[model samples]
Target: MARVLMYTTAICPYCVNAKKLLAQKGVSVEEIRVDQNPQLRTEMMQKSGQRTVPQIWIGELHVGGFTDLWALDKQGKLDGLLQNN
Candidate 1:
């Protein structure tokens, strides 16, 4: 399984859905609460080039957010990503 990291807020619906989906895929996410730390949010933006809650990374691969994740899953690409790392 790949190491999953997510930049998230305390109360985000997309984050919640993203977590739920990752869980359903049998992934345990390392969640960084950007809402609690502004610096982390800045880091997430710098890392992903996207200022959004639930910026996810599978190992070194930036997976964007919930919609991008869902799209990957739909394309049957997510499992391959997880398996690679």
Candidate 2:
């Protein structure tokens, strides 16, 4: 499986949903909590170009937030992304 990383906040529902979805896929996520640190939040925004709680990355691919991830899964493309780089 690909390495999954997510930039998230403590109380964001989207982050929770994203984690749950990834859990269902049996994929481990490296979560970075940006709620406590401004630098990490800046890094996430710079990397993803989005000021969102759940900024997701599958390997080197930026998969956006939970909605984007869900869309990918619905399209049946998420598994391939998880398995491939």
Candidate 3:
């Protein structure tokens, strides 16, 4: 199983949905609250190159935001990314 890391805020619906989807997949996520810690938001921007909540990472792979994640799942590529290669 791959480790999941999500940079989120307090009230992001996409974050909530992403978490729920991951939970359905039986994957535990490490939630980094950028709203509480401002530095983390900077780190998220640096890491993902995106200024958005729910910046998700599957191990070392940057999976972009919720829409990208959903696209991967729709394409049947998310499971392959979650598995250990």
Q: Give per-model TM-scores.
A: 0.97, 0.98, 0.96
lDDT of 3 by residue, 1-85 (tens): 9999999998999999999888988899999999998899999999889989899999999998899888989999998888962
Question: Tens digits of per-residue lDDT for model 2 on 23-64?
Answer: 999999999999999999999999999998899999999999
Point to the candidate with the largest TM-score: 2
Q: Report the candidate with higher lDDT, 2 versus 3.
A: 2
lDDT against the true structure, each candidate: 0.94, 0.96, 0.91
Clash total of candidate 3: 0
Score residue 10 of candidate 2 by CA lDDT: 95
Per-residue lDDT of model 1, residues 1-85, tens digit only: 9999999999999999999999999999999999888999999999999998889999999989999999999999999998897
In terms of lDDT, which candidate is stronger, 1 or 2? 2
Model 2 residue 66 CA deviation in Å? 0.5
